[model samples]
Target: MSRGTSEAFFDVVEWAAEQPWSSGKVGLLGISYYAGSQWRVAARKPRGLSAIVPWEGMSDYYRDRCRHGGILSNSFIKFWWDRQVITNQYGRPGRAARNWGPDTVEGDLSEEELAKNRQDQNIDNAANHFRDDPYYASKEYDMADIEVPLLSVGNWGGILLHLRGNVEGFVNAGSEFKYLRMITGRHDLPFYYSEEVEVQRSFLDAFLKGDDRVGWSVKGKVPPVDLVLRKGDVGFNDAQAEKAYPRRTENEWPIARTKWTNFYLTPDKKLTRLEPLHTPPKKLSYRALGTLEDPSLIQFTTAPFEEETEITGNVVAHLNVSVSADATGPTPSDIDLFVTLRHISPEGKEVFYTGTAGDPVPLTKGWLRVSLRKTNPDHPKHRPYLPWREYLSTDRLPVIPGEVYGVDVEVWPTQVVVEKGGKLVFEVASGDTQGSGIFLHNSPEDRSEEKLRGQNHIVFGPKFSNYVTLPVIPPKYGA
Candidate 1:
């Protein structure tokens, strides 16, 4: 099958050669599997493949699909492989069914039956062969070898599979000309499909087709390297059939002139920026609360704003943490931390923006699993984190009741300008707030169930400080 896949790709390249006035450059673009295949073929250094846009594609399935943090991520792989790969292929017939049979559905079945079949397949193929297995390693290509320009796109809400790879590829790829554009929405949202397609077309026209008009169009839409902030209506609509949003460019990612202030989370549930006079470490722990319908979590909010504040870019939450049971060792077990941004109006109204049009306004939001918080030194500005790591069950580092450890959380990217008198709020919890709906109701779960279900606590102290880092955009035109 791999041989056939490779042959078909080569045949496509051969077909490209027949054109009389062929442009030497070819740009590959697609979502998920279609996007994934581009990486597979581009790594081969195919002739005429000038640039590639791999949206929501994983470079290492073993690290991304089969396991996350050394724990099997079967639930995701099983569903994706069946829906996007197997079912689509097998639904046809002939050789397609032969190749994709076990991976796809052949007949109408209950959801439970389909899930069981997927789980079975996941177990059969699950292994840590990524490092030692030849087949797995072969799929893990060196992005450094891909010299062409690249526009890597990702979905922050797609916490399980696509998000991590898009960020990693953009940060690690060898291409000098690379850009990372992330949207906050559902994994299967149509905006991503249509909007990203437009972005790819404009990008390809500029670099691959050498179209100056399209190049200028693309360049004009890009915000300045510095922080730029523009507040207005933004959302997705099928009516505007363009590939990329008509973004209001800012001077920088997090408008530079804007001040980044820290509002500490107090033990008494107070949100203050003032430092404690003789602060000592404080510890707080909550048992797992809520089911798929209810949630056990903590919510924090600042007083109503006196003026407008526009926030964008990556948000980091630094906290000292520990776990109740040292499941892995003497040290406390590591748990995931979920953070969210909410807007409370003077009239006691709650407004939350999904970053989609017609939703309430959003300042920003972030999430981080304590153990999965490893940063990439290459792109410090971007602050990339990897969730795939092994655990040492023998060496327990249980959280000492009062000891302080720093946990930096990364929020999903957003562009929002809060109006004066609007309140900014932050919440910290142990479980999936989306699944349970404690603060804001996000439809999807960013982290996996296995990761979110673990027991953990957020420790605070004079030595252990917890605060949020916000990217503020300065006023436009030097105002």
Candidate 2:
């Protein structure tokens, strides 16, 4: 699939360069699908491809879009495949009639013929479970091969999709003059906002036209990272309100001064900084096979803060967990852990962010399929706050009933300012809960009743301490 796209993009680039009216240097721009394809074609180093601005697009097809924590993200794939992809196929019969587009030039393809030509991503994704499988491997590319000048824009509220890819792409891409810009707002509006468009133009102009007005082409003249701080309850989905939040520049990501703070979870359902003082083992249980309509979960919350505390960057949850089968039911083979971080305002209101669909969401979300809990701490990308998982067939671990296993779950990166008297809540659930929006993982075949229906437990003891490590950012001196 990526090969076909890259070939077509290369052909176009070569064709444009030879035209009499051409500038001979091509730059790419756009958001979503357009931005995503830029990563693939740029990695190939096509002729005349000078620069790229992948605005809110994913780089890794498997990790960022198809699977989340090795669990198939079926809902978004279905929504995207049906409406955004299939309906626009080149030879669909009634496209002109329905005002979608013109019919095929030679004639429309029959339904049967069309079916043979295209792959249904929804079906293909659910059938393939690991990164090493041929289905996913064919789409893989090394971001380091991209040597073009790059500007990757990521949205903080796009927790379900594009956010991680943009950040990861900027980090891994071999571009010596790459920059990362983070934003906060609904997915579509922010990209077209006048301020954002200006940033995009200045970057493209500096690289493509050799105009270095903004110092983009001159290394060290401009900070490599531009971040939007999400502070205060600005109300979700309102662009103007979101603008009130401040912006800052950083020389590096995960900010070098980050204080990796651990907040332990107690049997009493509290999140505190102090470690437990010699307590007997305890566990909290929730019904398995939970759903959005009927969620089954547990929450551990922190007390009101004595002063303002800002939590920004990647988060990881270290938990000792196990699962048990119900009487007379099938044996449980796996456990799906859905973890969410929420902010409580000083007035006791839950602070929500603008999710991908403009829906109210918590601070951030993370997931893990217990059977795929294996991690490679030695991997170059692995960090204390963000553990790397290969999600390959060979990495699959056993999830036996009545056996406890310790796992580190990677929560998507996020930012928030917990005001004085405000609080933070750490929630663990068996299925999709609030803030999931359209990106859900509820496939009957993947999360079958025979496999996941059971009692999921979080064990707590001196030997098994459950805690969430937050990337706490202190204010810059004298700022």
Candidate 3:
């Protein structure tokens, strides 16, 4: 994308509205980039923009697309920028030949001129680490400013990127008739599903054409949330099986009746509801800067569930952690924490779900740069289940050796139903583990040896017990 993208779209919307055949009420629709652009343009409050369906699009550019927990998501950014953005750039030669689009109407720009015009997103993202920095702050817009009717369809498998923004956008947008719809399956296929397409048409018809068949035009007539439950492992990337996973309606995101349960991490590697007490503090160490190829991590497993249990919504892990420098390498300065939630079946099989790229994935993942761990408890978006951090340059905390820091890791929201005898595993790793797919945080500049390479430890005891708070949803009355 281009700077002033929303403005450009707004101009086109205005022009289309004035056309002879136009209805004067335009609706925005699409997935991914098309979906992402809607948020920005809707916030601009474009004339004739009556409604929007931002299906599987990210709302926050900096937090959602470029960085994950203040660590640069370099891999995906590079891939997308190179394959999608640059190849489709205006005035780029050979586009028509490559089936990318027609060659520039104004003829192609010289390679030198093209280089001068475009900013390399990969390089810029790695260089800018804080949201408060100009590079990110310049792209910021207030979600609350958007007053259009919205249907934000988020993908359960979009754990690495668009999922957070969809949830956050729906929660923050100022639209009086805003609704959230959650879905599953591959990112590209779900949007084109016949049932999903019907939803898009119904919403647009309700707002744009005054066809209020679904009662969408009437306030409070329809439930504000529609959720697709990931009940069982239908196997990853199986569209047909995932479609049978069942659906439900709720009045709000996070489901108001959610039972926020804490599963304590014990020294014995068990995850229990009861907090451990009166035990000597024990440290579990893992080599820092571990990669997917050579993972160094610790796991805490819950006892098999005697009955069916449903885990849904956002998750947070409160850990008592510290780090020490290795004998020979440069002294460590910061820590990057990668946490994954995995589902295990009664027969001891790990259930995997479809990821953003159709790869096998765990339940969900979360990350945090320890130095940027200071959270804003007073922020309006802050919740007991979710901590909101500004990721500002001024919020940096010292990460001295031997100093233990109690930090909260915000695991991406997830949904999984553990069957009888099924288990849930909480994994804490030094770097990107399985299920990260192409969205790895391996930028050398961002995770330098001098800053993050060391021995990372999770201290466990009564005073320093670590626990993952899971949003356990119980059966609703009269279901």
Candidate 4:
């Protein structure tokens, strides 16, 4: 089952291996789609495949790309398939500036020729396949099968496509010499930065040129991890000046001295460290299929912090909720919830980050369908970072009407420094039935247009442990 891209490239590698004057040892390297394909091809363990450097590309088709938190992400995919992939078709204009309107050094192209040149991406109606069916599964290549020396490159700003996969690849690969190198910057910024390029050169030299003294083989003990800390307050702007100074490195993934803070959600919509009141289970209900302007989302916020708190690594929100019974039109069989992390400025404005919308995109986002809330025990845990989602068909546990179910959602990994007096906020909604929508609703969980109809009841009390486990990194005051 070939993924959407070219699988024949790997065949070329095999052919090159058997050449009359070949070294019989091959290494793959590229950025974006090129980087993405390296993972898929390396999984086959083709003869002579020695190394791979997947710099900022998606490794998983289902969870990482097409669908997020079990909901179909239509907007990004549609635009990607239509604009970049489609325009760059054989006869159409390649990538162009937004204001340029697809007309650049390449001449204007005919709509007909462009149509004839375009190949079916098969993602036109991606919303229909919510789970990892044969379609998405075929596109994914298991990283665990890759046994080559790997230098998985990633950028902290690669929240949309590469961050998680890069980390996962380094952790799961069968290779004994896998290393992870991450820098802080916009998606393409690190690719051209001199320091980042120098690092890449050394890795390539050590592996491809057999210069073992330069790469991980040197001394047999350079911490397998390298990262650049982002500077300043809590905004996630990865773009940086030529000299953003203060670059440093740590030995491992779980940064030292990371204090995990669990904030409990009170019935009164407050985020507090103290436990919720000992009263009976409290509920916040919203119309099952309400419109954007309607009262649909329930938000909880913590009080202004007295000091700055730098949060990095993963943040998990465990929700204990239930859906009220209803036999109305297209009654919902499960609940689809969109969870977003936000920072409130002292003056009362949502602080936007780099990823989503330009103004103040969510610091991070998470999604989940109540029916598939179960976790896999065998899934080697990433601990406080990634919640091992059991996406298997057998592992999915259905939601019973009026039954309380616990769902764990992983907010994308991020780096932010919340200054004193700043507040953290959590917004919850059964569906994207609000102006602050993160993903377009098309999956079975989305109760939009009366599709999966049911009132969402968020229960919070002693038994209903509704809280967010945040990896809080306090300021290095003495350092």
The better candidate by TM-score, 1 or 2, is: 2
TM per candidate comes to 0.68, 0.97, 0.98, 0.81
* Candidate that scores best on lDDT: 2
Q: How close to the true structure is residue 344 of candidate 2, measured as C-alpha lDDT?
A: 94
Q: Which residue runs does candidate 3 get wrong by more than 4 Å?
A: 1-3
Please state the error at residue 55 of candidate 2 in Å: 0.7
- Residue 425 error for model 4, in Å? 1.4
Tens-digit lDDT track for model 4 on 1-479? 24545368778888888898877877887877778788888888888887788887767766766667666766566666766666565445544554424454557567887777665553433533544566655676667888888888766555555677777777777787888777654565567778677777777767667876554656457677666554444455535541452555555555676788898888888998877667476788765543444546788999997887777777889888887756555555777777777777777766654542222355666778777787765667636556877465665676766788887887667666676888889888765533233335544333454445777888877678789888787554553
After best superposition, candidate 3 residue 176: deviation in angstroms?
A: 1.2
Cα lDDT listed for each candidate: 0.54, 0.90, 0.89, 0.68
Q: List the residue pairs that clash in candidate 2.
A: none
Tell me the tens digit of each residue's lDDT in model 3 across 5-76.
777887998888888999999999999999998998888887888999999999988778887878888989
Q: Which stretches of candidate 1 lie over 4 Å from their true place?
A: 1-23, 36-44, 55-75, 89-121, 124-144, 153-200, 216-246, 250-260, 289-291, 325-332, 345-347, 354-404, 435-455
lDDT of 3 at 415: 88
**lDDT by residue (tens digit), candidate 1, 1-479:** 13346457756865684567776666777777666666566666777777778876765565444544333444455665666654544324343445644533554555555455432444444543233444444445566666667777665444445655666666566765666776654445643556556766787787876774544235445532321233333332332332233344443333446566677777766566675455665666664322334656666677666777766555567777765643553433456565666656556666443322223334444455455545444543344222223233332233343344575665545455666766667777654454212222221233434323344566676577777666555555665
Residue 271: error of model 3 in Å?
1.1
